[model samples]
Target: MAALIMVDEPSVQGGRRVSVFRRGREEHLGTAFSDHDVIVFLQAAGLSDPEEVLDDPRWVEWSGGRDWKRPPMR
Candidate 1:
């Protein structure tokens, strides 16, 4: 039942999505994208610190995790 509430905010389909975070009565929503777009932009702006991720070339996203480690590629 609680999980259903999280899916209320529909994703941008093949684009960015606005998702809400739950914390008591304090709910905060943010954008969720399906690409490495933010990574490049953030990196170019010097905001994506930890050059490891910015230079790895293998990690091409803001997901802050490994690509191969993704869940079932689903």
Candidate 2:
């Protein structure tokens, strides 16, 4: 079976960022500051066609929805 990736909700504590994790793993793969960063992270993790990976539910599970745009500062 293909590896499952999880994109967590965006956090604004120290600027807007999203955490990427492998399902069932304790440690995260990395934090992404932008949508591009997420693609890069996935590429580094050996996933080809990052765009398709992001869209496919079988590969990625987006928490709190997939909002690539960074939220406005408070």
Candidate 3:
């Protein structure tokens, strides 16, 4: 099973986003891309910061929001 991801549009905002997933294909990666590493690019390229986002009190304060849980194992 793939680890739960914490970011969205991992590659759409970044260029050439890639990852070596432990899980195979056909799993809901929690976003449109394969991994959350794209956030690194977005943060580095001045688009977005994953750390800053995680620091947001709204997201952290909220408890009922969508969580990034591992996909159901086969």
Candidate with top TM-score is 2
Answer with 1 or 2, whichever has the higher TM-score: 2
How good is model 3 by TM-score?
0.29
32: Cα error in model 2, Å: 0.9
Instruction: List, residue by residue over 1-74, the lDDT tens digit for candidate 3.
Output: 23323243223333222222224542222222222544553344343445554435442222223233344445
Error of 2 at 29 (Å): 1.7
Ranking by TM-score: 2, 3, 1
**Clashing residue pairs in candidate 3, if any?**
none
lDDT of 1 at 14: 33
Candidate 2 TM-score, C-alpha based:
0.68
The most accurate candidate by lDDT is: 2
lDDT for 40 in candidate 3 is 55
Q: Superposing all C-alpha atoms, what RMSD in Å does each candidate have to the true structure? A: 10.6, 3.5, 13.3
Report the error of model 1 at residue 37, Å. 1.6
lDDT of 1 by residue, 8-30 (tens): 22233433332222355423233
lDDT of each: 0.33, 0.67, 0.34
Per-residue CA lDDT of candidate 2, range 1-74, in tens? 54377777777642233334555564456777666787887788777889877778777777767766566667
